[model samples]
Target chain A: DTAVSQTPKYLVTQMGNDKSIKCEQNLGHDTMYWYKQDSKKFLKIMFSYNNKELIINETVPNRFSPKSPDKAHLNLHINSLELGDSAVYFCASSPVTGGANTEAFFGQGTRLTVV
Target chain B: LAKTTQPISMDSYEGQEVNITCSHNNIATNDYITWYQQFPSQGPRFIIQGYKTKVTNEVASLFIPADRKSSTLSLPRVSLSDTAVYYCLVARSNDYKLSFGAGTTVTVRA
Candidate 1:
């Protein structure tokens, strides 16, 4: 069974449009995160959610929003997608712990292309 | 969280032992050193993790000295399939907020 899985493995849309990517984890992890890898191949954290609460919110644009209805799911929605928003978005999950040592399991990633 | 630094790239011949070193000068006392391997078009996969001294598993070996300021990931008899980007991450805490560094890209020649 896949530990972490994501939907819309490939996405192509026009600028100013809206899109969403879904992620799910069967590992029973309470923490989930979203990361974006740019054309330069630099990966940066966008958001993190634990137990349905927001934890880490980087300096991302306000147009990007992450929603987690439950511990096993975390989804990302982008509004008014811009051309610069084109990149590969990855979803990952890790077990919840008091401190930080848990290793995260990542999904296959969603390639978003904004025209 | 401790930031790690590694070489941008390395080249190795097939069947040779490859060792990639990562330096994390500000590693915290509770931080654990972890290594991950990522092939192009795929997410990273965990390789080995260690607290200190040496830790070996079926895939790779992690070597950390007493100071814990640096660590080395040794891959024995590397093959073409082993060519990928190797990332070194310092587990910030048990909560699992992992921060990834640029990582070292290893290219194995036939």
Candidate 2:
């Protein structure tokens, strides 16, 4: 079974269009995250939710919003997307232990193209 | 979050062992070093993690010195299929905010 999965493996939309990507994890982890990978292949964390509570919010534009209905799911919605929004989005989850940092499991990722 | 520095790219041959080093001079006592591998068009996958000394897993091994300023990820007998970008990260134990720098791109040639 796939531990982490994201829907709409590919998305192509015009400028100013809005889109949403859905993510789900079956690992029963308490923390979920959304990361954006640009064409340069630099991965940057955009948002993080711990047990449905917002914990980390980067300097991402307000057009992007993350909603977690529960600890198992975190969805990202982008409003009025622009040309610069074209990139790959990844969903990841990890179990939070009080000790050393834990390993994270990432989904296959969704490639979004804004024309 | 501690900043990590790694090689921009490296080339290797099949049947050779490849080792990529990452430097995190400002790492704190509560931070841990982790390595991740990412193939083209796919998300990054966790390979190994360690607090100090050495950690060996099925796919790779991680070595950290006593000062915790640097870590090295070693891949044994790499194949062409092993070509991927390797990332080194340092974060606190309970911190879910992971900062990933430009990873070292390993291109294994046959």
Candidate 3:
């Protein structure tokens, strides 16, 4: 089984539309994170959820929202998408109480395209 | 999250040992240095991590000095598959912020 998986490996929509990307982890991790990779291929942290608590949030747009129903899942919802929003979004997870196993496992990624 | 400085790009030959060094001058005392490898269209994968001294895995090795100002990731017997973007990051034990920079893109030639 894949440790971390993302639904809708690719997405395409027009500008001003709303879309959502789903992520899940079966590795029993307590913390989940969202990262966006732009055209420059720089992976920037968008949000982090530790046991349903938002701990790390970067200077992202208000149209983007992250919802974590539980530790295993973290969903990202985008409203009024723009052409600049087209990029690859990745989901990662790690154990909060772990020390040696602190490496984050990343999902396949969702390539969002806004025309 | 501590800022890291590394080469923007590097080139190596197959079967050669590739060493990529990352500098984190203002790294915190509790922060650990880690390296990740990313392919063209895939997410980054953990390579190695160390607080200080040396740490080695089956795939790579991490070397950090006592001052902890910088670290080096050494990959032995590189191949074409080893060519990828290598990112260096510094974070606390429990920190969740992983700020990835424009990592050093390593291209291995045959």
Candidate 4:
């Protein structure tokens, strides 16, 4: 079974369009995260949720928002997507050990292309 | 979060062992060093993690010196399938933010 899964393996949209990517984890982890990787293959953390509560919010643009309905799911929504938003988005989950984060399991990732 | 520095790239041959070193001079007392590997078109996968001394797992080994200023990840008998980008990160056990730097790309040739 896939521990962490994200929907829409590939997404192609035009500029100024808004879209959402869904993620789910069956690992029963308490923390979930969203990460972005650009053409240069630099991975950057965008947001993190611990047990459905926002914990980490990086300096991402306001156009991007992350919502966690529960500890098992975290979804990313991008508004007015721009060409620069073309990249791979990954979803990951990790368990909290004595208030600390442990190793994370990542999904296959969703490739988003904004034309 | 401690900043980690690793080689931008490395090359190896099949059956050869590869070692990539990472430097984190300002690592905190509560921080731990972790390494991840990423293949093409896939998310980064956790390989090994350690706080000090040496840690050996089936896929890789991590060595951290006493000063905790640097660490090394060793892959044994690498094959072409082992070629991937390896990332070294340092973060507190409680820290939820994981900052990834430009990883070392290991190219294994047959």
Candidate 5:
């Protein structure tokens, strides 16, 4: 079974369009995260949620919002997408423990292209 | 900003040992050194984690110094499929936000 999975593996939209990516984890993890990889292949953390609680929000644009309906799912909605919004988005999850569950497992990633 | 610096790229041949080094001069006491690997169209995958000395697993081995100033990820008998980007991260506590750098791109030659 895949530990983490994201829907819509590929997305292509025009500028000013709206899109959403869905992520789910079956590892029963309490924490989930969203990361973006740019054209240069540089990865950056965008948001994180723990048990449905928003924990970390990087200085992302207002057009991007992360919604976590429960402990197992975190979805990202992008509004007014721009040309620079084109990149690969990743979903990750990790179990919360004293310290044993420190590693984060990532999904296959979604490639978004904005024209 | 992250407290680590690693090479921009590395090259290795098939069936050779590949070691990528990352320097974290200001690693905290409670920080853990972790490594992640990324392919062309995939998210980063956790490779291994270590606090000090040496740590070995099925995929890779992590070598951390006593001072925790630096760490090395050693891949045993790499293949062409191992060509990808590797990231070294300093995970601080459970809730500390993760910071990712440019990462070292490993190119495995045939």
Candidate 6:
């Protein structure tokens, strides 16, 4: 079984169209995150949810929103897609403790292309 | 939050050792250094984590100086399959956002 999985591994749409990417993890992690990797292979944090609560929100535009129904799933929705939105979006999860360190596991990215 | 800096790419050969260094000048006291590996068309995988000195595991080893300003990931006898992008990150226990920089892309050749 895939520890972390994302649906529609690839998405290609036109400009101004809205789209969504779904992510789920079976790792029993309390914190889930969404990261974007641009063409230069730079990974940037977009948002994070700890037990379904929004914990980290980067300086991303309002068009990108992350919704976590539960601790295991975090979905990202993008509105009014632009050419600049073309990149690979990845979902990740990590077990958090009150004062301990842990690592995050990422899912196969969803490559979104806006033309 | 500690911002990290690392090389964009590196080259290595089979059966050779590879070391990638990451710098975080403003690391916090409770921050831990972590490294992740990513292959083409796939997400990143956790390789190792360390706080200071040295920490070795089955796949790799992490070496950190006393200052904790930088860390190095050492791979022994790397193979062609070891060619991947390696990301260095520094985060505290309470931090939620993991700022992944343009990781060092290790290319292991024959």
lDDT of 3 at A36: 96
Best by lDDT: 2
- The C-alpha TM-scores of every prediction are 0.96, 0.98, 0.97, 0.97, 0.96, 0.96
Q: What lDDT score goes with residue B21 in model 5?
A: 95
DockQ ranking, high to low: 2, 6, 4, 3, 5, 1
Looking at model 4, residue B9 earns an lDDT score of 99
Each model's fraction of native contacts: 0.35, 0.62, 0.44, 0.51, 0.42, 0.61
After superposition, candidate 3 runs with Cα above 4 Å error: A97-100
Put down candidate 6 lDDT per residue, A74-110, tens digits, no spaces. Answer: 9999999999999999999999822246688899999
Model 1, DockQ value? 0.50
User: By TM-score, how accurate is candidate 5?
Assistant: 0.96
Docking class of 4: medium
lDDT of 6 by residue, B1-110 (tens): 78899999999999999999999999988888888999999999989998889999999999999999999999999999999999998877867877788899999999
Model 5 root-mean-square deviation: 1.5
Q: Assess the local accuracy of residue A41 in candidate 4 as a C-alpha lDDT between 0 and 100.
A: 97
After TM-score superposition, the amount by which residue A58's alpha carbon in candidate 4 deviates from its true location, in angstroms, is: 0.3
Candidate 4 stretches greater than 4 Å from native: A97-101
DockQ of each: 0.50, 0.66, 0.56, 0.58, 0.54, 0.62
- For candidate 4, write residues A1-115 as lDDT tens digits: 9999999999999999999999999999988999999999999999989999998899999999999988899999999999999999999998862123468899999999999
Model 4, span B4-110: residue lDDT tens: 99999999999999999999999989888888999999999989989899999999999999999999999999999999999998878668877899999999998
Return model 2's CA RMSD, one decimal. 1.1
User: Which whole-number lDDT from 0 to 100 does residue A13 have in model 6?
Assistant: 99
lDDT of 2 by residue, A32-108 (tens): 99999999999999998999998889999999999999899999999999999999999999998323657889999
- In the range B7-103, model 1's lDDT, one tens digit per residue, is 9999999999999999999988888888889888888787888899999999899999999999999999999999999999887565446777898
Candidate 1 residue B96 Cα shift, in angstroms, is 4.9
Clashes of each: 8, 0, 0, 0, 0, 0
C-alpha displacement of B48 in model 6, angstroms? 0.4
